[model samples]
Target chain A: MAEPCTRWDAEGRLATERGETLDAHFAACPDCLAARAADAALSARLVETGARWQPPGDWEARVFARIAREAPARRFSWWYALFPALAAAGLAVFFFAPRGGGGPGSPDPSGAGFEVQIGVVDGAQVVRSENPKPGDTLRLTARVPTRDPARVAIRIYRDDRTLIFACGGGEVPCSLADDAVRAEVLMTAPGAYRSIILTGAGPLPAPAGTLDADAAAARAAGASVTLGEAVRVW
Target chain B: MTPTEDNPTTPPRASSDPGAAEQAVLALLERDDRRGALTALMRLYGDAIYRHCYGTLLDADLAADVHQTVFVEAWRDLPRFSGRSSFKTWLFAIARHRCLDALKIGRRRRSRFTTDDDAPEPADPARDAETDLAARSMLPPLENCLGGLRAESRTAVLLRFQESMSYEDMGKLTGELAGSLQARVARAMPVLRKCLEAAGVSL
Candidate 1:
């Protein structure tokens, strides 16, 4: 039996670089040849008509202005070099700051001793810690590194799975929750933890250091913490 | 291979006629006269790019956006243009990528004004008939037939027939291998042809 002819159309082929194989087939196949002729007629008409359409007034100028204004800043910035230093300081403060009971690395006062810090991450921000244990609390403080003052979203993933997420929405200077930073979720089992702070809707993976420290600090800080069936902390 | 061992004696083919405009634009841009370059590009290929975009997008507003983006991106990346390919070809490549992306976005957003709905009203059937009576147009029937194709088919056809680019270039723009692209085009032609013939177009 002859092979069944597959359904094909001109638009898809036209979008392709090399001319369509269907065109070659059409050159021989009477049915396809007829269709190709009709398409050619319609294309010319559309092209002629489309050429007359004009853009809105001042659109080009506006686009030009926007491009000019944003172009230079999009280039490499000098502030990139100071990131590690700033991160060290933030991590030091987060590690050194008194926990829920007023002692450095103290577990949550009420809940399972988990404290999550949510805030803007500056270019210089970093998370730090030594060792982490279960029942211990982890405290995170983020400082987003953007001059625009837009709040970024913080999402934590443990062992490649989501754990907690917090963001200030549109509020300036970012936001923190009542007891924790923004929101907190417990990690029942933890091997390697990751927190990704996205600048926008798309997945902008936080730098490698951002999450390692948050998870490590959370584990180390929360060591020796007791858990209740239902406990509520800020 | 060393230049002496290779076909070094052969002369380079002159660049496409359209490349002169790009060269001129580059010269002006190099002098920091981006405005002049924009004007020159507009004058040289504005109508072609606009119409091509319109054909691909099927909406005037979207076409305009694509046009603006193409030029803006072109200007921004002009400094990085290495001149490895013909300028017009490069521009067309950019336009093709933008058109495909715009179409994808439009589809995801459930766009209504596709190329299928963008046919021009015949100003005068009698006059057009009279003009067609004398002028031997190559692809009128095919154009109307394109509207009936799936989005992918329509785009492929337009890029191939209207823009007249090589298969290799299409592969680069669409991220499809040559064999795959060829297979798709082969599969697409019959549907397009049948649609065209049904639209009262002569083979």
Candidate 2:
């Protein structure tokens, strides 16, 4: 039996390795000739129509303009109106709670003074807020004073489980940006949560159970740690 | 920290490499020039995205809506974009999800993808100006045959033929295995062949 004709069958030979000009085989095999012709024709048609479905000329301008006009998902919710109060409230409640070192004049081991800002994910834009609605994705963006490489992580303390964001894992996703070390934690449900940012020359220390415990652990991490900032989520 | 000096927005797209646009986008992003980055990105992937949305959704308004949503979502996620996947792949991933979401809502009646293949083609609908299908009384036979295909097969064929995407790239965009995409195109071919034959259209 002759080998079946396919594209690999080249120059009309069903099995060329046997070194036969199989022109007689192709002549006898009408199905093979028709199939081959049909395949080539189909391929040609596909190529011909490849450039057919061009998008409209104004598509780019119109789409970009629409993007410009429709704001990012910044509905701001009802809570945006309460930012000033929330900011002050955070300073009182969480700020004074307990901070170990790396303050304004504290031993500056990392050589960088950092400002940590927290916000809710509004579309791709992160709107700065210490108080984000329950279920809001919490974005962490911080500026370290030094140009040195600094690794940043976020540990959000919840009643059930303390979530940590450091390079990997979906629970708390963290990716170190070149200019800004950024992380985002999904605050799944409305609950009491205390979120803290941990930065270090090396890897950050894992949380030690509770928010306060984690804070103590961070402070103990010492010169190994870059900087720390905490936010209280109501 | 924002760059003290704005990095050059002019893209470093060397002529030789295929990934030049993506590189340009990354360069803009590295400079913290988001607006510039967006411009570069839109220029790179905008047409493919808009076409995918339109072809998948089959309605001008819904496709336009999804196209904008995908870009808006892409802009929002720019800070978080880790470049883990090729920018084109990642953006199409978003496009696919938004398309699914629109489908789930039964948005704009997907009858374009759903109407029976044997049934008469629904009166062709909407803006020829937006579609560039103006001044045509009816689509050519192949197009009508293409529209008659099952949605998945139609999408596979169109992406292969119209968008000129490889099976691997289509797999990444559609979340289907490359082999599955290959089989889809294969399955589509015979249906297309039969339809074309019935229409008395050669090739």
Candidate 3:
């Protein structure tokens, strides 16, 4: 018995491989050929007489403008609003609460001096410094929170320069002092320097998370306005 | 993320109507005034919407009302866009949904008696003078037969043949699986063929 003359028969296994055997079959079949021809004739006639349709003018700018207005506020606020509302609120309420024998007017120890926490995540240095600059020789001081010795790294960058260098991390395990971990480094010039204390807090922990609005703002807190500062700085 | 990412170019497209003016109107619409969206919609799709209504409902004036209603509904709902789909696709979905609703109501009102396939003779002299007048007239009857089909099959024919959408894009707009869409088209072909043949149109 003879097999049906299908597109697969004409084109070999390529049609089958691509999963286009149906299209191939329709293309090759005389029945489908006549049907398509009739369909084409009917369509052309209707189109010639039918009203034309097009997207409204200014559709692009309109759609984009709409997206632009919504995208910013929605994306940034997830962390921005959440952090200040929750973390900052908790901190505020804690600081405001009565402590020891003193009332609300009493001076707070945490408020008197700078508080810094440093850690290493996946071999990158993450530091919360009160007043750090590029040229300052930071002493390595750790109290107890430091863990994963090799995961800690200190990256220093000069102001107005793209050169980033690894000042510390490999052989020297960071030393703990009271509440801060210190690493000594010489900056080429005094400028704004960023120290990140990466903590593995997310589902997919990496060196650090993307700089969301809250994290960026937190990095700015208590950072020195001066290009360079003396010893005992956070 | 990008225009090309959403609207992949597969084939040459028909010259899009001047989109700048419609955009201007939309800007006004987005400004909390719907007059501009309405005016722009009428200018851009008034005729097309009317045709769509007529095609779907087979009534001229109701089609006109549907045309107006589409824009009004669009104006009311424009603020809800979330960018998950293109504005064009969203708008068409609305229009398609409305057409289907109107069709359901139309079916309830329509008698169950089926219409015969007898060809209506043209009374106009110019049409009579044409060498292929009968053939030309047969095309409209075939299209009218297409109109009698379920909404999806009718729309599939119009978008594929008239709008020149590829099956992939058609699937996206209609929310049909690509495999199923191909099968739908194949199934629809015989009905359309029979319609055209009954209308005395030669393939």
- The prediction achieving the highest lDDT against the true structure is 2
Write down the lDDT that model 1 would get.
Answer: 0.46
Q: Once model 3 is optimally superposed onto the true structure by TM-score, how far is the C-alpha of residue A131 displaced, in angstroms?
A: 51
Q: Residue B97: error of model 3 in Å?
A: 1.7
Which portions of model 1 miss their true places by more than 4 Å?
A1-234, B1-16, B104-148, B196-203
Stretches of candidate 2 above 4 Å error?
A: A1-28, A72-234, B1-8, B11-16, B104-138
lDDT of each: 0.46, 0.55, 0.43
Model 3 stretches with alpha carbons more than 4 Å out: A1-36, A52-234, B1-26, B30-33, B110-140, B166-169
**Candidate 2, after superposition: displacement of residue B199 in Å?**
1.6
- What is the C-alpha DockQ of each candidate? 0.10, 0.10, 0.06
Worst 10 residues of 3 chain A by lDDT: A223-232
Interface RMSD of each: 18.4, 18.5, 23.2
Clashes (N, CA, C under 3 Å) per candidate: 67, 3, 21
Give the Å error, residue A183, model 2.
Answer: 22
lDDT of 1 by residue, A27-123 (tens): 5765444445545655564445454555665555645766678678645321122123334334211211112233432323333222233222223
